[model samples]
Target: MITLAEAREAYRGYAPTYDLLFGPLLQRARRRAIRAANDRPGQRVLEIGVGTGLSLPYYRPDVRLVGIDVSAEMLAKAEARARRCGLAERCQFQLMSAEAMAFADDSFDLVVALFVASTVQDLGRFGAEIGRVCRPQGRIMLVNHFSTPAGLSARLDRQLSRFAGSLGFEPYFPLDRFLAETGLRVTASAPAGLFGRLRLIEAGKG
Candidate 1:
């Protein structure tokens, strides 16, 4: 497994081009996650691995947004994006790891992870940290690509996993198992794309 430092280094040189490569598809996923969140007017939202703040614009004005990312370069991009959107005051950025968040327990009304699970070094630890900071009845929204259940897509996913390690991604996490281990219960799971390919999972603190 790669260390957080290694992942940070890998992303450092890629921050600028990161959005260009992933912006469109990820933006689509982010919109789905936001819809799953069903954010009320004044909710406190915590976003993990919030690279470049691409999802910041989707958040409602009344919702308080706190974003955390491991890469300093990515965080800088996120900061710039926040300023560009004129949401600097409402959006806060912090350099932190998802495996060990600094926030206190039960702090946020909603926590979101967008296309971020695959990058975590320790899925269990990341899930635990997410659970720790989430309020008792709060919601967690995740947008992720997973190993498809059968046939050709599953074969491709297997092939992708081999390359994923080098890129600091896990390819897929066993969604049900991870949720159970994390003390979260799935409230809804909807296909975000064709063939139930990319998924949007909305879970509540258990």
Candidate 2:
């Protein structure tokens, strides 16, 4: 039960060194996420929880991108990174909550969340919003860690649950449950990252 305020503060503290720390570790997953999207020129893409804009440089130059994060501190760094990487013209960074986005329905061709499912306070609402904003045939790309069906990873996630409230993520989040609740249809999924701990999921609105 990590409150939004606590999640904000946690990210504020992490903003400064986020790129140096989590950036390298999550880069592989991010790359995988964007490539799987297969975005086209002039398409609009929304990136939820686009921390520090690490994925900013990876998107093709022709696409239009909107990246939103709850933490202003993190968004500032993302803005700077976009400018530094010469992606400023193609990308926009804003401070907005994922669960309640301001955009209208059926507004984007693609939506993405990288390493974000664990951090969202209301995943159901977030999923609904993702579906609402994306066109019927649009894609929802996610690269995240989910509780393994069984084995060591599953056990470890359960053990980590005790610290979830303080850490701002619900460890042991079940994929089957999440998909069912969100009503998102998964068209593709593949193991990713170290020991296949992370997953790359491509889904469409049902």
Candidate 3:
């Protein structure tokens, strides 16, 4: 496995081309994630690993948005997007790691993380931190790819994990089990593709 620092450095290089490469798919996923979040107006929202602010446009105008990512370069893109979307006043971006967030307990009503679990070096710690910062009964909306059961696709996914890692992608997670282990109660889950290539998980902190 690659070190977190190495992964961060690799992503810095990809920041420029990241949106161009996955922008469409990512936008679709973000829409799905936001719909699953069921966010109401005036809710406090926190998004982890908010690369390029792809989800910013979907957020309700009345909701206060806070975004954090480990990559400053990525955050810069997100900031620019927020500005372009005329959401600069409603949203705030910060440089922070998912494993150790610097926020008060029970700070947010809704926490979102899209396509982020696979890249985390410590899944357990990341989940725990998410739980820690979220208020009781706070919703957590996630869109991620994970290892599927046995099949040709699974084999291909495993093979691709190698290249993905080299490119700073963590594209597989046991999301259901991870949430359970982290004490999150999953309220709903749906596969984003016919082959279960991506999943949308909606849960609440217990």
Candidate 4:
């Protein structure tokens, strides 16, 4: 498993080229996750692993947004994005961990993580934390590349699994097991991104 410190170091190096490299590739998936949020005015949204704030502009300016990531370098870029998008007033960025957040119970109307589930050290703890912060009936959104039941995609996931540390995320994380272990229930799911390699998931606190 990738430790928090290792993840932080990996992202620190990645922060410089992250947008240029993954921005275009992952933009659609990010947009899908935001759209699935169905945000409304006055709702508080928490974005875990909000690297470089790529999704900041996608969210409505009326909704309050708090973005957290483990890498200070990434958060710095995200803060800059918030400023560039004139969303600094509506969005806040912090250096925080997904596995252990500081927020109180039911503090958020919605919680989102895009392309981040695979990077977390403990999926169960991360999911539980997400559930704890999200109010009952509130929504949780995740956009990620998960291991398919059995197919070429699954084979691809397996092939990439060995290079997780260098890639910054695990490629073969099991979606169903993650949800079941964390007490989260998926309300909706659909293919997202190129070749349907990613999934856009909507869930509620279970």
Candidate 5:
């Protein structure tokens, strides 16, 4: 399991070059995630593990956006990006954990967690926190590069699992297991990234 400490340390190092390294390569998937949100005007949206806020500009200016991240260094960049993108008025950044968000029940209309499921220490807690903050019937979107079930890639991922802790993410987390652990009512899934290796899972809260 990837601990909060490990994730913070890993992202601290990635903060400076995060946009450069992940920006273009992951841009397509990021776009897919934002589009899937289908946010409306005046809606409150929560983005967990918002990273450098590369997806901030894509959100509608009319929507209220709150982005939370565990890493201070990354959040600083995200805040700076929000300012640069002129999103400061509609966007808010906070240093928060996905497992324990600082929000009231049913606080948001939508929650987006892109590339975050594999990084958290406990999927169940993360999912529970998400469900609690989201209004009943609210939407949740998660985009991640999940490993295949039975393939050469799956074996390679298992072998790499030993090193995943240090890397700050699990390489072998399955889609079905995530649903079971999170207890989310998934509605649809769309292909993202190259060869559909990245998945955008859309769900609803009860």
Candidate 6:
């Protein structure tokens, strides 16, 4: 498991080139996740692992947005992005952790966590926290790469997992295990991103 400190360190180094390295590759899924969030006017939306605020512009300009991340380095870049993009009218930032957010209960109508599930040290707490913050019948959306059920792809996931600490995210996250551990019930799921390697998931709090 990748520790929070390790992930922080990794992102500190990644912050410099993050947009250039991951921007294009992951942009499509980011757009898809934001679109699927379906935010309405005045709804409060919380985006965990907001990283560099690359997903900020994708959200509806009318909805209220709050972004949080554990890595200060990335959050710094994100803050700059938010300023440059004039997203302050619609969004705010906080340096916080996904596992232990400071927000009050039912604080958000929509919660989105993109490419962050496998990067945290504890998925159970990660799951519980998001669930706790979302009001009853609110929505939760996740965009991640979960391992295949079985086959060559599964084996490849296992092999790639060995470098997870360095990679800063596990490559072998299983969908069933994630659902069971996080206790997040899928309202709908669909393939997204390049070659369908990424997953776009929507769940309801109720």
Once model 3 is optimally superposed onto the true structure by TM-score, how far is the C-alpha of residue 18 displaced, in angstroms?
A: 1.0
Compute the lDDT of residue 67 as modeled in candidate 2.
Answer: 93
Stretches of model 1 off by over 4 angstroms after superposition: 172-174, 180-183
Q: For model 1, what is the error of residue 127's alpha carbon versus the real structure, in angstroms, after optimal superposition?
A: 1.3
In candidate 2, which residue pairs clash?
none
lDDT scores of the candidates, listed in order? 0.80, 0.84, 0.80, 0.86, 0.89, 0.88
Cα error, residue 148 of model 3, in Å, equals 1.3
Question: What would the TM-scores of all predictions be?
Answer: 0.91, 0.94, 0.91, 0.94, 0.96, 0.95
Off by over 4 Å in 2: none
How many residue pairs clash in all the candidates, one count each? 0, 0, 1, 0, 0, 0
Candidate 1 local lDDT, 74-123, one digit each (tens): 99999999888887888899999999988999999999998887787877
- Candidates ranked, most accurate by lDDT first: 5, 6, 4, 2, 1, 3
**Candidate 5 off by > 4 Å:** none
lDDT of 2 at 174: 74
**Which regions in candidate 6 have their CA more than 4 angstroms from the true location?**
none
CA RMSD of all predictions:
1.9, 1.5, 1.9, 1.5, 1.1, 1.3
Count steric clashes of candidate 2. 0
